[model samples]
Target: MTTLNHYHYKRLQEFCSSVFVKAGVEKEQADIVAASLVQADLRGVDSHGVVRTAIYLKRVEQKMINPKAKIRIEKEDESTALIDGCNHFGAVVGDKALKLAMKKAKANGVGMVGVKNSNHFGTGAFYALRGLKEDLVTIVMSNASQTMPPTGGIKPFIGTNPLAVGIPCGECEPFLLDMATSVVARGKIIVAAQKGEAIPHGWAIDKNGKSTTNAEEALKGSVLPLGGPKGYGISMFIDIFSGVLTGAGFGKYVNNMYENWKAPQNVGHFFITIDVNKFMDIKTFKHRMDLYIRDIKTEPKAEDVEEIFIPGEMESRRSEQRKKNGINLSQNVQRELTNIGMKYGVSLKDALMLNHNTEGKGV
Candidate 1:
């Protein structure tokens, strides 16, 4: 795989912003969208990173997504609100919802927000982490397009349906966990297809509901839930909160990723934020959390287990290295990005550099 230097990645962010501006997104909103993508890459969520630029551009060209959306709060209560995203970019809607939730939390000690008419937002964790600085525990969930099937059914009926949570820690990085409720995210399948590689069995079923290892076959088929019915159940709940509560499209009503170019995906997202200080002394809670984490780390390990790590630890470590050494994107992604850059008159070298650089900081 080829790699982009740090400065180049920063340039990518700049490019994204510039293009978004050209497409009619406000400067501030463009920056937020770019930041969301870069943050995903920083946190090791490669699927949501720079590779998505091409998809966004195509969506704009097809008019499936609004290049310049006007978001507004449709309704509001003391501790909850509903946002009409006006078919904006998911990052824009998500950031707006998070800000609204935090504001309500400040006023009521806890807050929740539901958003609709959005597109793909990056990793759900990016939005959840916004609560950490405010001494709040945050949860973010999104109901994506149908890509996964029910536990025993053959046809697709649910999206990857991700759930993410962020908690303030005592001294370590905040406890952030973002994961797809499915066995694997559709992004992985896309990556595999790009590489012309086979996926592992159990990841997905063929069009006839039979298990398959070929990425292409799986794409025609349906992905599996993480733990059979248990994962399916959780996905359903996520769907209810993100889609049902928000009154967005659900189940088969959701738009197919590639097929629908002019219709809003009608994607929905939910944000739950709770101020930790409202119930207990913030310091005391931190101290107790620290003790709990310490005990968890000290627990006995089985053979072949060199270390026991919490959810966010590995991501933090990978981020440090990638920030310095630059990320090694898969060969297929590199090629695709290069091709897209060519269309926009951005040189391959410039695109690579943009992929490598940090967003706000100049390399």
Candidate 2:
């Protein structure tokens, strides 16, 4: 069991905020990114969350990502637009893009936005929820660096691209689904390697294209897509739309997290926001969605199955618990946080206490 030191977690957030601000991110924007990353840890999406902070700071220092990149609408139509990310951090650009999409959707019946020259965004669900607040169904996808291999080939050729969807249901929480195309995200492999742990089979193959449980070997190899070839096709489709079509980096042309330093990644993303009222009545859609979820969950399971899970249901519940109880992180994460705090000369434990008291909330 990995135990995260609470003091270290709080300190990490402070350190993340300070670095972001030093990089010229506005205070509010820095806070948002920091919160989003921390939220990922709280929700059990360790890969996307705070774990990437050190890497992000490194990119910022290298000037590969603009600390103060300006965001601009390069093109606009009634319900469509294109955003130039100006090489900014993805969390900032994605939020800006989603805001524009929501605004356009409110004005029109639907909205679609494409962005280019962005950095890596944390989680897709963050943007998806933005659309849901407006009673809109949302879709988001992004292309990433090559980490997964093409079907039948050994070397990496495609990224573990992700697709996310969110549907509003009135008073009920939105039905949200966000996932990586790979059987497991690259971060999991990295984490496993860091911990000297063995990954499961079918999750990765070594450089020789043989399945292996060794995380170190998996790092040298490539991950396989879920459902075999079909998943690879889906990931490729995402690359085409979010990368090639947007004129962003694709395949090996993209920046490798392990190597690239100076050049902007020129990443791309797609977002679609559809007003529920534009289709069937919003209530009708909500009730139908509720029924679908309820029925699927209520159905009988095999003897070994303990329970069924809807994609976001467990996540939402876990988030609630963490929000109230504070998030627990692993020892490695705590060590990283401690390092970050020491670098900044700030005590993480002190910061947590300050934050807790400032919010007038008890733990």
Off by over 4 Å in 1: 1-8, 351-363
Q: State which candidate has the highest TM-score.
A: 1
Task: Look at candidate 1 and give me any clashing residue pairs.
Answer: 6-357, 8-353, 8-354, 9-353, 9-354, 9-355, 9-356, 9-357, 10-357, 12-354
Residue 267 in model 1: shift from native, Å? Answer: 0.3
lDDT of 2 by residue, 49-90 (tens): 777877887787788888676799999999999899989888
Clashing pairs in 2: none
TM-scores for every predicted model: 0.93, 0.92
Write down the TM-score for model 1. 0.93
- Write one digit per residue (lDDT tens) for candidate 1, span 1-363: 233444344556776676666666788988888878777777778778877877877787778888567799999999999998888888989999999899888889988999988888888878877788778889999999999988879999998899999888888667888999999988888778877999998899999988899999999988899999999999999999989989888887778757686587989999999888888988988888788888888999999998888887788787766665555566666677667656666555654544434443434
